[model samples]
Target: MSEDDRTRAMRSPGDGRPLPQRPADGLRSGGAPAHRMPGGGPGAPTHQLPNAAPQGPPESGPKPGGSRVYGRERSGSSPIKPLRSRREPSESGPPSPRGPGRRISGRTVLKIVAGVLVVLLVTVVGLFFWVNSRLAGIDGVLADYEGRPADTPGTNWLLVGSDSRKGLTAAQRKKLATGQAAGQRTDSMMLLHIPEGSDKPTLVSLPRDSAVTIPGKGRDKLNSAYALGGPKLLVRTVESVTGVYVDHYMEIGFAGFVDIVDAVGGVEINVRQAVDDPKAGLKLKKGTQVLSGSQALGYVRTRKGGALPDFERTKRQRQFLSAVVKKAASPGVLINPFTAIPLASSATAAVEVDSGTGAFDMLSLGLAMGDSPVTTVVPFGGNEAVPSGGTAVKWDRMKALALFDALKNDKPVPKDVIDAG
Candidate 1:
């Protein structure tokens, strides 16, 4: 065949393109044969079209030492790069600069703390309202009368302990040795004076058997005022006698007294002497010890210890009351939920306060009593026989007047009168 005809026959039949000429060295760039010979032998020339793009250097192939370079290989067309994964960065370059991760600022932290405090404050406020609402109020106990004593410099509270069996069951009354009394009478009375200044408070006991003039009832034992006219008449009688205004009134019955004493666990008391009184249901040893509810009630009520039984009873009452107030206001009781809740419940349920008095006033009373108040009793002359009210104790007029005057003007009691009592 002619040379031109043989070359034409070497062209690709499908595209009618001429094949590439073998280089003179008879090898590819990497020293490998480009294609197979006509009979599938080595050392054949690679095919290429005349008008095709010029080939560049080999992008990947075997190297001089038989190690291969890994990359995109070139053809008559442009090189195609391998696809990269979205998660992985390119190994051919440094990773792109990234922004810092999110962080919490100081302001944000403060906002979180403030939110927590607000929630706690709301909870505390709600608890206060709930507890305050439980207080039982008595109406018109401190009503203004025509000749009532004028308001004094400091606060005065008329604290009355009544022998009312309103809440006590038969078994309880029997246990407490409280007879089946139909109507209630004042078992004990006290005037608690809280000075506005830094002076310590004063607690003065009013013996129930003392002779005092009850308005519209003439002269009789002081307790007869309460038995005849209840709280209103009793307050009037006390104010008229002492010349000191009564700002608040609180009364607790037998059952209430017991409940309160037990609620604070018990009250610590130092007994002056041993007493065994079956009538008052009190039998105690002399020493510093704690008294339970029933024992405390009897301890304060028994008139069997000193030569002047009633006088000694009044001292015991004052001593016990102050100790109880201190216990109720202690951190151990106020901060502990178990004791605090029960104490609050018992206290609020146990006492009847004037309409004007509230939980805050009671709190003030507790705080005042916890201050270790100076305790005394009305200076007395001697026992007397009253035609209408049996035997009654008589107060020393001059000394009693001086004591009440000091309290009315918010001045300290004269040391002579304090010692006299």
Candidate 2:
């Protein structure tokens, strides 16, 4: 076709109009109609084309359309040329898609998404390394066991029985006035449970003298399980007593326990009784008392609260533990980094975990227990001594098992259990 015919075809269909001349630098030039306007021609300042379109309003975000359109600054001498997206067609034809300023590829968007993913990956890896470094005694000591979760209805822990004989210096021994009996029996024993519920927990307090039918050694007190066959025997005895699978065990000695409590700046206990244990050399008047490791061990072991049954000792154990939990959770303890980390490290060092559980595994368990209610298991008929020997106290085995069962079923213990006098 001739150039004249081509120009005619490009003219606006709305009015029988001649096509305009093309500007050399304009971004959009449809055939011949490159420069037509209200005032018409080369130097006549007129609205040649509408401004470029902006992106739509974002979800929950402010719109930029009005700002982009109305506030656009117009150069006085420069002729307005349409950005292809905003070019108005006067019944002529559709504008060509590609203009110099219009986006042609999604390169910017792709780069942004990739950058975000990189940041997230780095954050995750940093957190993992920080937690790993904080865990002590877990590096090569535990191998052949990682990525394995403890899968059981409940968890059983065989807390350690330390020979306190080592903790006593010559002066300490003389102060207690025993002149070093070969080795006093283990002082503390406990089992912790993480049952299913908001505040549901079952703890069975075992007396050092509660006799039980041992696996191979016949009948003896439960504490004998540790001295006889070690942790394995303790696990088996607790299982036989409670009927729940023993998932894991941990043990700590007297020195270790004291070190840990001291590392955390000592634990606070609210005592209703003035504790004056001649054996432990703990002489503290009743009130809210913060005791060091040596003093803490004594307070928990004191049986001077009562004359006969020694039920007062058990009650004090629960009281002291509850106070420790509350104080440890308070900001004074949590924010004190020097005290907190050392305490955590010292406690972990003293604690010998179950064969399979690792540092992360143990951390998860502690986190789960943070909000759960913790209580010591109480015997049904308080504590009674053997008919002949007063040193041997008979623990209610059936009652202890019942308490554990209640925890497994996610049921609350009887109100009487909590309100025991």
Candidate 3:
């Protein structure tokens, strides 16, 4: 800051008193004793205290009285302290100008505070509605399917990471820089389960190449479900595979994802590797960094990002999600009321859900999931080589099913559900 700025900061807005001290309070602290005011010093004033009614002499001026009224010397030199009791009444004894009367009674102060909170509450609620109104045309694609509670027991969101680059104009393609519409398959897929009775949430990352039979689609690539059908088909396919019903679904395309990130400012994420992806357009040094929408989308979309492939990216996405949850749940953020409305209105606006799904249900579920520790379902189990396609992952299907059934029953998912995975 400039010296002038520093000087301005040091000086009070009006008087030169220190910034921490109030102007009203500074006025009270002239050579006067800390507690005394023009009102009077200490206990009952001299008039209230015992004193001879009157006395003679020019020292006292008494016209009505036959004798003179003289000030009495304080008795025994007893030191006096200011009267601070709440019970003291102004009318009982004339209260001092610095009234021994109630100094804004605690109950009254509390009421005032409550009144302020009510005003703020109304203001924030107004802001929420106003900002939400500003957001228009956010409705995106809506696809719905039947989802069961996680068999591993708890709510689960089966997020599908799509690689749909098709149906884009040249300008739109140039903006995201993902190149022309190139269609192959979904980049990644994962089953996010919140155990019914399980306190911590676990993310079970299913390999897109994992072999599984979609309900009626026959056996195929998990990402193929999206190509065959969009999120509705994909979620249905997942529900069929795991026997776990999905309670909710969120599908964020490249553009929507970027907008959501930018709306909430950005998020802090830890990077263990130097991501050098010319294809996805991500280039970053290793360590912790705040990623905006486009960068975040890249972080979750990079398939050749590290030795572990997109698994690292999925992990990053999960952590980023957790941070987002933390920020949303904080009172400071929620109190702003306007902050989350835009991001949430934007984010959810893009999401596709079951026909009856609404914001409150989504928010309640999110809050529950946020409080739980997030766990992943990337099984240590090996994958079986597909005859021609990518390898099929070998999973303990029974155990996984049992876990989901347990979630349906709101019971703890077996520890083996996690251990076996």
Candidate 3 local accuracy as lDDT? Answer: 0.60
Residue pair clashes in candidate 2: 160-251
Using TM-score, give the best candidate's number: 1
**lDDT on C-alpha atoms for all candidate structures:** 0.86, 0.57, 0.60
**TM-scores for all predictions:** 0.73, 0.58, 0.63
Residue-wise lDDT of candidate 2 within 1-421, one digit each (tens)? 9995775566546586543444423433111223345555564432334453321222343243322222343333343554654544434654455644455458888998899899878864664456455443322222223322224465554444555556557876565443466643545565566665555444445666665666677766667767776666666666666555555565555566667777767887777878777876678898887888778767776667667435666656555554554555556665566765565667665666655665566554555435545566546454444433454555555666566666555566665554542
Error of 1 at 266 (Å): 0.6
Q: Compared with the true structure, what per-residue lDDT tens digits does model 1 show for residues 1-421?
A: 9996886676646686655455533344434444434554333445444444433343455333343224423234443456777767666665555624346679999999999899878865765676679878889888887977789899999999999988889999999999897998999999999999999999999999999888999889999999899999999999999999999999999999999999999999999899899988989999999999999999999999788888899999999999999999998998677888888888888999898887788889999999999999999977788769478999999999999999999999999999988
Rank all candidate structures by their lDDT, best first, as comma-separated numbers.
1, 3, 2
Top-lDDT candidate index: 1
Instruction: Judge candidate 3 at residue 272 and give its lDDT.
Output: 78
TM-score of 1: 0.73
Q: Please provide, for model 3 over 29-113, each residue's C-alpha lDDT reduced to its tens digit, 9 standing for 90 to 100.
A: 1122122245653331222113423211223332332331133323334445455567556445555657444356699899999
